[model samples]
Target: MTVRTGDELPPLRIPITRTLIVAGALASRDYQDVHHDAEAAKEKGSPDIFMNILTTNGLVGRYITDHFGPRARLRKVAIRLGAPNYPGDEMVLTGQVTAVAEGTVEVAVTGRNGIGHHVTGKVTAELPTDGPGTGDAPGTGDAPGTGDAPGTGDGPGTGDARKRTTDSPATTDAPMTTPDTPR
Candidate 1:
């Protein structure tokens, strides 16, 4: 079950509650109390506040991985925060593929609140393909499919993307940098 282009993920609607906020924070190792306490969040600079970006993103990743199955390798992920997710607010995560290349499938992901967008996310996965989906055949699923995974060498995503594996799996886009920030 290597995911192919246009592979759709299941819908998720989770209410952003204090417990969730705390759990997300703890799961991501982000100990910022602002995410766990309303008053602390307010003192920091929030009206009602909720989980931090890292926490929100971790949940989103978990959601995708769980849906895509064990063969899924998260190759890329990008997200931007907008409206704050406060307690009692429902956050929905949805996505669809934008492109595929050499074992990689890219998807445009977004997180929205009841009223509007709270965050946007991008992710790519080197998923198991149609044949057995487990890549169970050695030289294929046994490895991360740097293209040599089993018989998928000639599979659908064989392109420049194969070269990207040498540096890192590129789980996220380039970090945002500005001229004003010191290099």
Candidate 2:
């Protein structure tokens, strides 16, 4: 596909349900009580259970792939959490293409909820030169929360979060860098 810097992706609104919060925590294997136990969260100073970083990271990846299509391979994803995503809120994800080079595209993303910005980050993806939807259907590839290569829950109390392919283990130990960094 022909993408350009400054292109904006359509915003995606996601309801923040208790089920979603608990399920995401469970799926990511982030047994952190603050993510699934309201009482525990309150005990820990949180008003209620909150969305974990792994879930937020996955959502950010989904936002990028949803715009660029399934052929888009996520090269790098870096994000930071802001406000907590509690049930009964909604998070609207939006992204802007920050840079495009050769067959790769970079986007700056934000997910906002009633409290404030829930997540802010950047995603780098390699899109197929053949255009959108040119490969396997979405959800057919490595999905977040699954024991897959990419989304292996690198959050608190989890394993490594480095990028990898389904067929092989990750080979890099370097830190996750922005698109400006040399690959």
Candidate 3:
């Protein structure tokens, strides 16, 4: 879908669990005990294990990119944490497009749990102008005197210019095993 200013992104709901908290912490390389050990978290004045900031940042990134598709590259993401995301709670992510520039979109996002806002941030992403759903046809947004046009294959502003195939060997093979899988 083409993104526009004031457009609301689809909400993402995630159930916070012990496994999710620990796994996200591990994935983000944050080994803080408060993120993985409930007893240690209690000692630190938390009711239970809380999510790490890195995980919250990652989730914010995921929310924006997932809304904008794979061609959208994040230019910047600034976030601040509020209420803690504890296990057994649900995090609901929501966002809205604040601005749409020539090749970029700015979004304001918030992730909230039952208690209150868990994370609030603004994300700036560069979107591919020639890709599907970008709403920019060739020769439209290009600078003058560039001689760029659709179907001409002159510059990089051509849409649907390349042939895409889904017949890769990886698609036919079994899923690759990960380190967590048993032999």
Candidate 4:
């Protein structure tokens, strides 16, 4: 689909729960105590466990990509967190297209929770100019023959590994020695 500046993306509403906060933190590999431990968060000056920045980043990316369709690739995502997204709260995400050029779309986004803004940021994404629903874009998830064998060159893999070679100094005659292993 053709996009222009001032286009508003559909708003997304998400409920914040303990499971959501913890699951999102884990999914993003953020193990900070404040993101999972309510008591620990309280001790650290927060009312309870809160969502992590990585989770917010992922959500923001999801919001933009979902609106732009599968062909969209996030070039950059910059967000700042405000109010804590604690359990029992809800977050509403909204975005607007700030600029559109060649193959890129710039979006300004805000995720607000019950207390206040949870995240505010800008996202830059590349969209296929051919229009949406064409499914010919590189990452549109509708590529042909993608369901083939994992190592098949017909898919997304490099044709054949036999054509490539490593530049390591160690030859076939020598035992591999890494930083943890002595010669």
lDDT of 2: 0.74
lDDT of each: 0.66, 0.74, 0.72, 0.73
Per-residue C-alpha lDDT of model 4 across residues 61-96, encoded as one tens digit per residue:
889867766545666788999998999999999999
Model 4, 28: alpha-carbon shift in Å? 1.9
| Model 1 lDDT per residue over 1-183, tens place | 434456677778888887888887888888877877778888988876577888777767776666655455665677888888888889988888666565556678888897689888777666554443343234443355554454575443665356554323333332222122244
Regions of candidate 1 where Cα sits further than 4 Å from its true position = 1-7, 130-183
Give the per-residue lDDT of model 3 (tens digit) for 1-183.
455678889899989999989999999888999999989999989999998988888888888767665445566788999999999999999999777765567789999999999999888776665523332233333343333333455334453323321112121112222222345
Candidate 1: what lDDT?
0.66
Candidate 2 regions off by >4 Å? 131-183
Query: Native-vs-model 4 lDDT?
Result: 0.73
How many residue pairs clash in model 4? Answer: 2
**Sequence-dependent TM-score of model 4:** 0.73
Q: Tens digits of per-residue lDDT for model 2 on 1-183?
A: 346678789999999999999999999999988988889999989999999998888889888877776546787787889999999999999999877765567789999999999999888776654422343345544354433334455332343324332322232322222222343
Top lDDT prediction, candidate number: 2
Q: Model 3, poorest ten-residue lDDT window? A: 165-174
> In model 3, what is the error at residue 73, expressed in angstroms?
0.6
RMSD of each candidate relative to the true structure: 12.2, 9.2, 16.3, 15.3
| TM-score of each candidate structure, all chains considered together | 0.66, 0.73, 0.71, 0.73
Scored against the true structure, residue 51 in model 4 reaches a CA lDDT of 92
